[model samples]
Target: MGKPETVRLVSKEGFEFVIDYKAACVSNTIKNMLSSQGNFTETELGEIKFPEISTPILEKVCQYFYYKLRYTHCPDVIPEFKIEPDIALQLLMASNFLDT
Candidate 1:
């Protein structure tokens, strides 16, 4: 792609993340967002809040995004992310929070 275009992505839980539109597209969730016209909340300067994910997971995802973004320059397969069963419960809570 030429300089990558801007894209908007929102999680099922209602968390909207505004990274480099290209960077965000690295996510399958986002790629699908681009394919289908999904509802997104936008403000000036492309500010977005991804409430679906907590600060912790969002932080981790962001880090992973950056890594994948640069992975082409320095190729290496990294392990997939996994969370504890108990923490998975908290994620469920977070997901429910966005729904309600």
Candidate 2:
């Protein structure tokens, strides 16, 4: 089979996350960046750089993306997504930025 469709998301500190394209598109911001009409660097390179989001926050966002995709149509009960109180604000800000 051919290579799997994936996209790279780079955090503010240059932490890179390579994830499935479908999973990445769970975020409206990422989806637009990858599918925008203009030929931006992200679209060309299949990599998006989030300059304001920290590595830890980005990682959590990626996890949420996958979690959303996995359980969007599940028949079983979905578990609550936990977040530490300290990082909750940051995560919320990042999620707002990502438009997830």
Candidate 3:
């Protein structure tokens, strides 16, 4: 059987975001979770649940993953990854946890 090319990330509020597998792997935590030695269910199903991460924050994290992947190699051309002032704290905590 072929592995999925995308992964589903479900947020605390039950919102789901389907992203490219490569993009999802931007987060070290997620990469580990989907690795061959990681949890069998997640690796097989291509789905991960973030019970502690809110919908908005999870969406932002997903966006950052693609953004990072797009710009990681070109240092000077990378644009700023914006975070809303109100959710800055929460986003920081999530980023730290994901080790992105």
Please list the residue runs of candidate 2 whose C-alpha ends up more than 4 Å from where it truly belongs after superposition: 1-4
Per residue, candidate 3 scores C-alpha lDDT tens digits across 42-99 of 8989988899999999999999999988988875866788888999999999999998
For residues 1-100, what per-residue lDDT tens digits would candidate 2 score against the true structure?
2124989889999999999999999999889888999888888788888899999999999999989998999999999988989999999999998899
TM-score of each: 0.46, 0.93, 0.90
The order by descending TM-score is 2, 3, 1
Clashing pairs in 2: none
Local distance difference test scores for all models:
0.52, 0.90, 0.90
Give candidate 3 regions above 4 Å deviation. 1-3
Poorest stretch of ten by lDDT in candidate 1: 1-10
- Which is better, 2 or 3, measured by TM-score? 2
TM-score of candidate 1 to 2 decimals: 0.46
**Which RMSD values do the candidates have, in order?**
7.3, 2.4, 2.2
Better of 1 and 2 by TM-score: 2
- Indicate which candidate wins on TM-score: 2
Instruction: Judge candidate 1 against the unseen true structure and give its global Cα lDDT, from 0 to 1.
Output: 0.52
lDDT of 1 by residue, 39-93 (tens): 5433222334565566655544555566678765765776565655755666656
